[model samples]
Target: MGTLRDAMGYPVLRAGIILLVLALLISIAGLYRVDKSYSSSGTLGEGMHYLGDDKFENEYLYHNRTLTLSSTNATISLLQGSEMYNYTLVNDSVTLHPEMRPAIYVFNGEVNYTYDARAIDYPYAVYSIGAFVIMLAGIALSFIGYTQFLKDVKGGKK
Candidate 1:
């Protein structure tokens, strides 16, 4: 590498080296910490109030009653670790009708959750391989720039 560098001036090679370092740093950061999230289904109903430990609640207004049910299921989320990840919990299935046996059964409302995963599913080995490729490309670009600068100097063409 120094042999090629002797043909290329110190200053231009230094600049290329600086740019190469920056690119490599950026590529490494991109592969460092990836994350994800997920959501699931549950049952909600009308009555005393809390459901599924403490996740859901019941509210009454003007003698009318309603329930909010929540369920937990394994999910793949992306915004679990950072402030940039924002998600909304919208109920996909809200209403459950009364059952035929009125004495023993009642309405069963279903609530759904929308959340992010704590980590991405992709293997670390794959991400490392990709980062390695990016680093090589960055170094190659720096060397190419260094050679082009030397070529300009030799031709006396600026």
Candidate 2:
């Protein structure tokens, strides 16, 4: 134990510990509680069609819906682990924010989803605690190595 402590008695070790702790804190804050939601909207687009029994071929009545396809002013923050970009719905009641807010994806077969953010199903307490523990371990290891190096240098270990 004494020899181990000596190896970790360096300023570098202290800096390493601080860095590890900061990393852990940031990760926990960012990922510990992720909000999830789901939402969708239907729109009519004009395009070519098939002509059979007097059907409208290569034309659609929804042409005037062109103005409906305008983009909304919504920015999304995509997390590292998450596959979709989570965004907030703006004031517009009929616009889809780019972010994939985690709401119920399916209730019936309506094909329309709600736009809301929700906490993940799992509890974050456990993960937060584990991250903290790992950070502490990293700090301890750094400290030990630093002390050891200091001792070796002072005693001419070469």
Candidate 3:
């Protein structure tokens, strides 16, 4: 125990502890940032749903929509008719009413639609993961340094 304590008291060990603590603190900050960003992105609801279907210029159409809510506001985007006709509502709670247009068969009469309200930046999660990896490396380095110190102490006594 004394040797262990002495080993931990070394400058290198102290530096490793500092590094580990800093890494943990940065990781926690990154997680908080992730939560904040997610909340602000307004995608925290049950996700988008298929509103209904309509017809434009004798062609069948589908409308998929998603709503995102914030503290005092909401946003909605409608994926309807065509990719070039994405309708969005900002800071207002209203259903999408897509205007009728002549449907152009750009994809062999088949079109895929998707609405992603929860799409958010992931730099915070990346930062958190990177920090965690650094923290683990610091722990491993500290353990190896301490083991080397203990071996050195034992060798000196022998």
Write the residue-wise lDDT of candidate 1 on 1-158 in tens digits: 23555644556456657656765666666555433322323432322222121111111111112222233321112121222221223432222221110111122332342221122433343455565665666577667766776677677644
Q: Over 4 Å off in model 3, which ranges?
A: 1-4, 34-123, 156-158
Q: Which candidate leads the pack in TM-score?
A: 3
The TM-score values for the models, in the order shown, are: 0.31, 0.29, 0.40
* Backbone clashes in model 3: 0
lDDT of each: 0.37, 0.41, 0.45
Question: lDDT tens string, model 2, 1-158?
Answer: 24645544556675667668775775666454443332234521222211121222112122111111122333233232255433333433233332221222221122222332222433345566666766776777677767667666777872
RMSD of each: 15.4, 17.0, 13.9
- Ranking under TM-score, best-scoring first? 3, 1, 2
Worst lDDT run of 10 residues, candidate 2, spans 60-69
Worst 10 residues of 3 by lDDT: 33-42
Question: Candidate 3 residues 3-44, lDDT tens each?
Answer: 556777676666677779889888877654221111112122
Q: Give candidate 3's root-mean-square deviation (CA, Å).
A: 13.9
